[model samples]
Target: MKKETIKAGQITIDFLLEAADTNGAAAMFEFTVPAGAKTPLPHYHEHYDETIYGLSGVLTFTVDGKITDINPGETCFIPRGVVHGFDNLKQNDAKGLTIITPALLGPVFFREVADIVNQPGTPDLKKLGMVMAKHGLVPVVPKR
Candidate 1:
């Protein structure tokens, strides 16, 4: 088991534990989003399920065209193939935890995002899309 604390985008991601290297089934993370931080574009994986538990503040999630605001102690689940995304909607930091099942790709994907966000210059969205696609993640275009 390995534990790591890293910053990704505007969030601090703490890899509370990982089962990818051994069990190949699950991974857990403690995530914190600074005020005003927005998550990545809405996307879905073909074979992984994700669950988020809100620890504090408000989490605004846009899932399958519906918007819901989850408060502290609330939890939301995104089944495989369902498009979902979230943002920290409070004036102060928002803290949460995420658990992913069938952990094959999700952990690697998060690590990549952290790497990209730390690189200088504006990120190339198209390239990022391609990277995401390669990992079975499909990015959805949000409604205008």
Candidate 2:
């Protein structure tokens, strides 16, 4: 099957190995984060662990209130239920490979999110939250 690419805002995700390819064991994808783009909402997965391997540039990740910059050739493991978010604050785009266990999330989730995110004007937070919740990603609201 042909791989699918989903674009949500300034980020592009190419689905490399989906749940079908992995028999539900895992799903792998490559993502690109453009420089200067707004960071994704901090969120946590309640059902699957995620591992990210940096490919180029740097992906600055905030996990459970701790910030870390994952540079090329480095990796970060995010256990389930750990609130995490990332951004490409460098001058160049950051690329990476991500693998999630149990393959619970696939193109459908991203597609749904992309639809909401790519819409004209500001996206509806309530709808986005609903989609994320349906996919087991719980958004984290920052404390003032």
Candidate 3:
């Protein structure tokens, strides 16, 4: 199957399978975040669970305000409504597989984010916020 690719901030996301095809059961993707990349700000999903399985390099995750470092073969789960975010904190590349359960609107949000940031000008944060809201992705903290 052909994969959908998106550049969300400092990372490249390869959507292997979207939840749309799975009837909102799950969405899967492999993501590569460059060294020192700042990941998305802390946020929580109102209706879906998210999991990140480490595939390569180091990823520092902040889950519910607690920081933890994830290495290869490791996994972290963020239950629905739990605030969390992550970043590639090492000097090498960081890669992981992300899976969202009951994956309603995650793909749409990422696609929109890629489009907004890849354009020739400054991305519209207000527009992005609307998209998040539309998808039930509620950001508890401001983007850092």
Q: Which 10 residues in a row give candidate 1 its minimum summed lDDT?
A: 102-111
lDDT tens digits, residue span 1-42, model 2: 439999988889999988889899999999999998876689
Tens digits of lDDT, candidate 1, 51-122: 888888888888887898878899889899998988877798888888888775645666777777767887
**Which pairs in model 1 have colliding backbones?**
none
Per-candidate Cα lDDT values, in order, are: 0.80, 0.92, 0.84
Report lDDT (Cα) of residue 91, candidate 3: 95
> Model 3, 1-144: lDDT tens per residue?
647888887789888878668887888888999999867767899988989999999989898888988899999999999899888879999999999887675567788887777777777878877778888888776556
Question: How far is 18's C-alpha from truth in model 1 (Å)?
Answer: 1.8
Clash count, one per candidate:
0, 0, 0
Error of 1 at 68 (Å): 1.7
Query: Given candidate 2, what's the lDDT at residue 133?
Result: 94
| Candidate maximizing lDDT | 2
CA RMSD of all predictions: 2.0, 1.2, 2.0
- Sorting all predicted structures by TM-score, with the top scorer first, yields 2, 3, 1
lDDT of 1: 0.80
> Deviation in angstroms for 136 in model 3?
1.3
- Model 1 Cα displacement at 138 (Å)? 1.2
